[model samples]
Target: MEPKNNEEEWGKTAWEFLTQVRTQSPLIQCITNFVSMDLMANTLLSAGASPAMLHSLPEIPHFTPRADALLINLGTLSPSWLPSFNSAAELCHSLGTPWVLDPVAVSASPFRFNACLELLRFKPAVIRGNASEIIALSMPQHSTTDSTKGADSTHESTDAVEAAKLLAQRTGAIVAVTGATDIVTDGNQVVGARNGVALMQKITATGCSVTALIAAFVAVDKSHALDATVSALAVFGVAGELGMKEAKGPASLRMHLIDALYGLDEAALKSHVNITSLC
Candidate 1:
C-alpha cells in the first residue's frame, strides 16, 4: 500500500473518474429545491449528464426506477414535497439504486433535522455537506460556525473531517465535506480534495449542484462510491477554480463555472488539481 501522507497520490484516480462521468452522460434524478433548480439542471447538463427534476409524490416512485441515480437535496423542503421525498427514497432503497443525500441547512431546523434522520434510515450511498452541516449531522454537540443561517458555511472543510468520518462510519456511506479544502471519507480512510476556488462559495447553489453531479457518477459506478463522491467534488471544484479567473462576480462566476465544467477535460484536471493524501 502507498503512503497516505503523500498528497500527490490521492486525487489521481478521483480526477480520472470524474472525466469518465462527463464523457458517459449518465441520467441523474434530482429532488432538489426550487432555488437551485435552474443552476443544478444546467450544471448537470454542462457536465454531460441528463437531468430530471422529480418532486411529485404520485410520480416519484415511477421516476426513481427509471433514473440511473437519485439525488435528494433538502435545501428548500416543504410539507407537500415531504411525501414524495420519502417515497422516492424508499423506492430507491428497494430497487438497489444508488442515491446521494445533500442535507442542506440540516443544522437550522427541527424539520430538516428529522427529515435527514429519516433519510438516514434508507441508507444513502453518499452524504455531502458543508462543515457546519456535516458537524451538525455527525456531531450534534459541536458548535456551528456557519453564519448564513440556512445556506452557507463559515467553517473550513478541515474542521469537519472528524465529523465526516464519523458520519461515514455510522451510515456506511461516503461523506464529503466541502469548504476552502474539501475532505471526503469512508469511516477508515480519508481523501482530501484540493481543487476548488474560494469564490465558489460566493455563488449560490454550487454545493447543491455538486451533489447532483455525484449522483450522476454514482449512477454508473457504485462499487467505488467513495471514489465517485470524491471525483465529482474534485471535478466541480477544479472547474470553479478555473471559472474564477475569468469571472467578474458571483453571477458571472456561475455562468462561467458551467462553461468551465462543459469544457473540462482530463488534461486540465491533471494539470490543476492540488490534492494529496489518499489512503
Candidate 2:
C-alpha cells in the first residue's frame, strides 16, 4: 500500500497507530541484548505495550504463540543465545506472528553476520538496523565486510537507502535504516522521518528500543508494516526532540525521552512530525 504523501495524513496515521497500541497493549516477546533489555522494556511500557524479554529455548515454544509480535536483537549474541533466538523465530514463523529483526553490529562480527543470514530464512516482517548493518545484510555475497564501530554506524542513513530498498525487495520485509534522518521503505514506497535530536545518539539502546517499538506497532497493525515502522520512528524522533528541550545532557535526555513518549499525543505529532513520502 502507498503511504499518504501529505504530512498531515501521515501524522494522523501515526497518531492512530500510537493510540491503537495504547488501547491494545500488545504483548511483545523481545529476545534482545543484555545492555538494552531494561531500556527496551521501559520504552515499550512507556509507550503503552506489554513487553516480555524471554529468550530461552524451552520457554519460547510456549511464549511465541501467545505473543502478538517478536523482536530478535543480535547485540550481545552468545553461543547459548542461539538456540532461544532460533526457536523463537521459528515459532513466530509457524504462528504467522509478525517479527522484527535488529541486526545490531552484524557487520562487526562473523558470528552475527552468519546468524542474521540464518534468521532471514524464517522471513522477518521488518528488518531494522543502522546503515552499515543494512548494507552488510543486503550485499549479494553477504561476506563483504563493512566498517562498524561497535554497535555504532560508520555509514550515513542516506548511504543505505538503496541497500534498504533492495533488501526490502529481496526479503519482502519492510526495512528501516535509522540515523540523523530515519528512512523506512517497503520496496515500493519510501518515507523519511526527520524529527529527532543529535543527543539521541548519546544514549545507548535507543535504536534497539525503536526496533522493539516497531514490533509493537506491527503487532497492532500488520497490514501497514511500512506505515507502522515510519510512524514508530517519527514518534521516537519527536520524543527525542521534546526530550532535548529540557534535557541537560544525554543522561537527562534519556529520562525525558521516555516521558515524552508517554505523553505523546496526536496534537504533538501533527505539530512536530516532519515526514515526507519520497516515492
Candidate 3:
C-alpha cells in the first residue's frame, strides 16, 4: 500500500494519541543521564505520564514488569549504569513491554557505540537520537566514529533520514531524528514535523525528555509505534514553538516549554500540529 500524505489525518492521529496519553497516564521507566533525569521526569509529568528513574540493577526486575515502557539513554554512560540498562532492556523484552533507546553521543566513543550495538539485540520499540547518533548507529563499517560534539549533533537532521530508515528496517523500530525539523520513520513510511523553535536547542535534555515522551505515547498504543513516536515529536515541537513566544531566552524557554506541554490539550494538538507523511 502506498503511504498517504494527509495533513488532516496526521493532525487527527496526533490529537488522538495525545488524548490517550493524558487519559492513560502510563508509567515510564527511564534509565537516563543525571543531566536529563529531572527534566525528563518533569516533562513526563507535564505530559500526564508517570516517570520513574529506576536504573539500579537490583530494582530492574521489580520495576520493569510494572512499568508501561522503558527508556534507555546513554547520556551519562558510567560503569555502574551499564548493568542496569542491560537488565531493564532484557526484562522489558521478556515481558513484552515497549522500550525506547536514546543513543546520545553514540558516535563519540567506542564504548557507547558497542553498548548500543549490544542493546540492539533485545530490540527497542523506538530509537530516538540526533542525526549524528543515528548515522553512526546505522553505519556498522566505521570503527572510530565522530559525528557529535558532547551529546550534540554536528550534522543536520536531513543527513540522517536514510540512516534512520535503514536502522528502523534493521531493528524493527521507529526511528526519530530530531533537529530543526523532526523526522520519524518506520523503514517504509516517513513523517516530518515542522513545528519547533531554535530556542529548544539551547535548553539541555530537551531531546532526551522528548524520547521519554515518546515512551509514554508508545505505552498507550504500542501497535502504532510510528504514529506514536511522530505524535510525541509533533507535540513537543508544537509546545516548543508555543513556549518560544513567551520565553525570554533559553532558561525561560525551558520553563515555558514545560508549561506549554501541560497546557496542551486535544484541541491544541489538532490545531497546531504541522505533520505530513513522506513516502
Question: Which structure among the candidates has the greatest TM-score?
Answer: 2
Q: All candidates' lDDT scores?
A: 0.82, 0.91, 0.89
lDDT of 3 at 196: 86
Of the pair 2 and 3, which is ahead by TM-score? 2
lDDT of 1: 0.82
Using all chains and alpha carbons, the TM-scores for the candidates as numbered come to 0.91, 0.98, 0.96
lDDT of candidate 1 over 1-279, digit per residue (tens): 333354344456655666666678788889999889999999899888899997878787566798888999998888887887788888989999999999998878777788888888898999999998898898554234535366687677898888888899999999999887778888888887778787788778889999998898788788888777777887888889889889999888998899999998767876777666555
Whose lDDT is greatest here? Answer: 2
Per-candidate clashes come to 2, 0, 0
| Residue clash pairs of candidate 2 | none
Higher-lDDT candidate of 2 and 3: 2
Write model 3 residue lDDT over 1-279, tens digit each, in one string: 235467678778878888888899999999999999989999999999999998878988776899999999999898778888899999899989999999998877778888899899999999999998899999885457464787888999988899999999999999999998788999978888888898789899999999999999999999889889988998898899889889999999999999999998767777888887767
lDDT of 2 at 14: 88
Q: In what order do the candidates fall by lDDT, top score first? A: 2, 3, 1
Off by over 4 Å in 2: 142-145
Per-residue lDDT of model 2, residues 8-65, tens digit only: 9888988999999999999999999999999899999999999999888888877789
Worst 10 residues of 3 by lDDT: 1-10
- Ten residues in a row with the worst lDDT in model 1? 1-10
